[model samples]
Target: MIKPSSPTPDHLRELKFSCLDQFIGPFHYTNLIFFYQADAAAADDDENGYKSQALKQSLSEILTVFYPLAGQVVLEGNSSINCNDNGVAFVEAKVLDGRQLSDMIEEPNLEELKHFLPTQHFVVEDNIVLLLQVSFFDCGGIAVGFSFLHKVGDGKSMGEFMTAWANANKYKCNKCKCRCDDQFMNNFNLASLFPPVEFLRTTSLPSTTNLSEKFVTKRLILDRKKLTDLKEAIVSAPGSQLKDPTRVEAASAFIWKHYIIDSAAQKRRQIKLQPNVDQVEVVVENAFMAQHTVDARTRMNPPETNVFGNCFLIAATEIVNYNDQQQEMHHLAYLLRKAIKKIDGDYIKQVQIEGERYFTNLFQRLDPVLKGKLGLCSFSSWCRLPFYEVDYGWGKPLWVCTTPIPLKNLVVFISTPSGDGIEAWINMLEDDMKIIRIE
Candidate 1:
């Protein structure tokens, strides 16, 4: 890993953490990789070397404003960043065996994509807050991979940091007189809003770890037309009161339904194998729920989207029955709408009032999933986020994608560069993926 060109300023040491930061539960790095086609002329002109130096230099400047990222998270007194200006881990790699970027994009594979990320797994150690890798391909294509602790911030914060760094690189902010640090002050004073609960300090939250060999990740694209068609079908269906289900709701409902179908089918297969079991007594238990991620920025009275900490929460719907296809789709979408709608201003106030009790109950709800009795489909929407806006003086990325997530039944939605479609990056069991592909 390449270290920062210069050490962090001594005055910026000891970054403080808000209660919102502690709510992130565990230390896990969110990953993404942006791809760019190889520049033919630059291939012979040593542009890759130039690009690497530019990124490192710009990152050093960006760290001054985002000082917390440059340091490590420590548990002194409470959980906060040491901000010692140690520096972030940055590295460069090459696509092995002359593989081109298109080869991986055309037929996306989680196993191959994992190689692009700097980490061997999702675990964040050594006080490392961020990990970045710039990979070069034989065809001159470059894939910029980024992995950062979710505790640092949510997708919105990540997008903001990326844009700021890119701008610093493109414009050389040292020449500009404007103070950029003022722009990154949203993360301050979050503790007053969501006070840290003592229970969080006493008990560790449960985390699920699925076998990598047993899981597979796939990318499913739904264009505007397709989403419109799905929404229309939902509205036109029998007993439908919905006017227009959003792209995220529709896609999530559709994908969740497919997961249920595949799961139930697998249960049936297992039942058939047991010849001694009574068919009538053999109950195929199927319970599913959606953990829809909601950004707390707009939910607050004054709007805190600019806040730097993890200002996001999960709004989970009630258990959705796996019934007929069309019926389930509409029901899931309606439940999702209701759940998300409840997360407005009042909800934020309630959370602040409830505090520890609220967080404890939220943690308890995952017990079923932790015990392998329930299926939780976690969906995070990055559709409206400005991930594609990071220019870095090389033009916007040709394609922005993420690697396979470590969790099962986790799906992330990204907006296509054209802003006309949603790309669902889904992670599931290998058997379930086979069923999804076949159906």
Candidate 2:
């Protein structure tokens, strides 16, 4: 296990390395937003105030927790890109009028922020930003927004770091330090295990020309009763008797079906100029079905385990030709379930190989259509996730929401909200969402 040590001025410089870059994926990034309620009468000053003291303590703790992992964090390729390549710095705290805070939410300064820190290419230029915005609400609550680049870590790692940072701050670690672990810096050869060139193919991926106007976020809460009923319905359905149909499988199947139906209906409303265009072409795609399980190798082999950073991989799944045929919801669900089941031991090895092959020869064989179609829809189910235990001192957050990053066609975030079954946060084109008929 890695332990903390004293902080150094050149700590970040020491941690920089190239090997860490290869592990991160385009969508592996994660950020944690914490909301706090401050005393209304608290004064805002640099020297000695309740809020000031809290902020200082928090910063100190953040540095301590982050410093040791700075090399690991930076080399890991999330927030490091912002600090090193781009001139992105962490946001400091300040008092904002409650009215202004509320207004900003309705009309976010997305363009202004983008101008401040434009997106950078991952391979050529690293541009990842971590922003912490504090705004006072009329009710005396503080709104904290932690915006992170999605290419760095996933939701789980982000949550773990936040909890640790909060704990260090709350306890007031006066003698905080930074320590580097050799295991974190070790270079492992992954090329051999990945796919070879012979089995690879490249095609033009899809691209997004126009984005949706007027974005909104909705939270759908699934209680225990509803969850149980949904599961029972699925199990009793024909061919769903697989001994144990996990909740993630069942929920994903349902959501995927919903998305297909919604997309088809939207396409029907669009005006097609082609003559005798009786059918509308609408495809439902997901970012990738990410199955986060403890690496079996880590448990079985002691020396080979490198738990310094994230040890997970995302497997992509989609219904390519939704417009080609009319299929029942349950039938689609069964297909999805079957696809997920196919991702067992041997399948993971194939995925690793294929992924490596794609990256190695990405530039040469790139397909225009496939690239454009990528990220048309994303589904992430964090059902068995441990996000709630991410308590610093005040306790876990009351709620969390993500900003609308342009280019992504549709995004879905599934989390088990505090005291509920599951929460699905869906972001899609305003027009596309309009056609969704939820029963």
Candidate 3:
């Protein structure tokens, strides 16, 4: 375990989770891995003691600001954090005997990458909010993997904490006061605005960990030209409602289209034994839904992107008539855009006013799909997130990616270093992925 180099100060201890935090509950952890080429400048020792020390010291200092990360998540009394500075689980691992970095990551094996992550395997204890693992490869390359419980933070929150830590390391400010804490506190007022409800206590976030299905994760890179063509096609396609769509909208539309096509074929194959029900009609009737987790920091009134915690919600759009012959890419993009637009300041305010009722209605609609009644496709785009900006005193990471997600029909998009393209880390059933890869 990686303990803090110095003990946490008593004054900056307990941290509370906001009502938004209660929405997601405490089951999932978001994982990220960064790879760096070994620094040629520091070749003194094989252990790379200097780099490790810098990382540990900077992390300990930053814990003072991002204090809740080091503490445990408490489910009792409305679910808050006891920021006692217990420290994060830090691990050091060596790459396989004969493997080089290229060999390991050329076509990433998600299960193998999980070995480099802290904890036994995505286990979240009550007190552990953050865990990190640093792996040293024989080729002088290093992989840094870390995960934080979703209860205390979201992608934005994690990115902020990482950026702060990197800043501390780059400047050699072991005791630097962080401005991020101020931004983190700004989100506290939102708690009163959007208070918790009784329904949340009874509602359980659906777990989609299906052991029967074989899951696989694969990387799909959309370079500048491909992305541009997609956007152009989405905007110009028949039934197109949008004049100019964002890159994410274009990519989502493309992926959703292909996913629906594959699902339709899969449905056809499954219903060959049952001739009574029309498979085409069934496919059209039960179209897969696309849900995107939208970060509302900028969407909120007075627009605050600097705040911390789970300041986001899922915006879902339905896809009907999956087997339609027409070009539905534009329509898909339109539907996604419409759903995202609904998550405006007024919608947030309505949730604040109708907190319990809002969540109750939400659960009623969501609980069914979580129980495997329907096919759901989820996306979380980290294209705008500054994950690559993390320097950590050793220079920028050569590659940043995520491990295999446990659930299927999920895609997480991250920006390439060039900032012109997006890397989609897609997870789905093995057979489905094989079909998807061909598409």
Candidate 4:
């Protein structure tokens, strides 16, 4: 365990959860892995020992700024963090396989890659807020695994924490104490802005509709050429409603088109298998839903760029006629853009004014998916996030990866090292994957 170098002040003992944070359940973590190549110039017999000690010390110093991380979640009435400076969990391991980091990064194996992290899917049902694991490879490379509680914040919060820790570790051996302490000391104002709305996640609205089925995660790299081609194809079409769609927009549209086509085909096959099926009654109109997770930090009227809390909106787009628009990628991309554009300043302001009404609309939109009437596929993009900035005195990471989440029909987009290619980590039902996997 690594405690804060300095204790948390008594006045700031409790960190309340924002209304958005209350929507996320307890004990779910945001897990990510960063691989670093060992610095050849700093070679020594005690490299691992020195690195571990330096990491622990820097972590202790940085914890003072992120005090909530060193505390436990108090789940009595309104969930809050007990910032008593109890500290966080840290672990150290050395890989004995003698394989270099380069051997496995070309096309990562999500199943075997789970060994690098502390958990398979970041669910431990524990009150601990965060844990860090630094695994040293036999070839002198290093893998850093970070698991942070989801209830505390979203991906943006975790990214800021990781960047701060890296900055601390970068100046550990040096005499610059200022570098170890993050400059942003303002306490997060999310709790004050959006107090916890208990009804958003009460027991009365439990997620009992969850399907118990096996899901598999797969990674695919979409290079720059493919993305450019897709964007051009969409924008060049006459009377196109898109405004030069971004790489993520184009890529997501492409995938959604294929999913619609294949799933509609699968539904036809299943319908034929049933002898008494009424063909006219089973018209699969808009069976698939496309949802995109957007960070609301920049979308706010007065942006909350540095705040730490759960602040992402899932903008879901519905296809009214999937059969007609299954192959129309341009129309699909345009509709996605339109949906995302609707979640602007006015929408968020309305959300803040009427909390219950916002959740009512949310549940109403989710009712069909929960009832198995619609397919749910949400996209989360970390392409422009703060992963490449991590440098723990050795250097920036050679590769960055997020562990597979347990949720099915989820797609995560990550930028490659070159920043020109995108890596799509998709998770879906085992049988549905077979249909989507078809070339």
Q: Which pairs of residues collide in model 3?
A: 72-127
Model 4's TM-score against the true structure: 0.93
Please say which candidate is ahead in lDDT: 1 or 2: 1
lDDT of model 3 at position 356: 73
True-vs-predicted CA distance for residue 86, candidate 1, Å: 1.4
Candidate 1: give its CA RMSD in angstroms. 2.9
Please give the distance, in angstroms, between residue 206's alpha carbon in candidate 2 and its true position after superposition. 8.2
The prediction achieving the highest lDDT against the true structure is 4
Candidate ranking under TM-score, highest first, comes to: 4, 1, 3, 2
lDDT string, candidate 2, 1-439, tens digits: 1112335345343432111224343432243344443434443343224543464455544544344332233433222332222222344444434343334434544332221222222121233334344444544445555554443434544554555555555565433321212322342222233322332222222233233345544445566676677677776766554445555555555665666666655454552444465432223232222122233223222233433233344333443455423234345455555655555566555545466453444333223224543223445655544555554455565554444443333344445445446665555556556665443
User: Which scores greater on lDDT, model 3 or model 4?
Assistant: 4
Q: Model 4 over residues 1-439: C-alpha lDDT tens digits?
A: 8999989888889888777777676357788899988555543449788988999998998888899999887766546789988888898887766766777587667887777776554554356788888888766788999888887878888888888888888877342654434355674678776666777545223242234777787787789998899899899876678968999999888888888888877887787798698755466433777889888889988887888888887788964455664458888898789889999999988877776677777778878777667776779999989698888878888999987776767889999888998988887878889999522
Candidate 3 lDDT score at position 416: 83
Q: How much lDDT does each candidate structure score?
A: 0.77, 0.42, 0.74, 0.78
Is candidate 1 or 4 superior in TM-score?
Answer: 4
Candidate 2 residue 350 C-alpha distance from true site, Å: 5.1
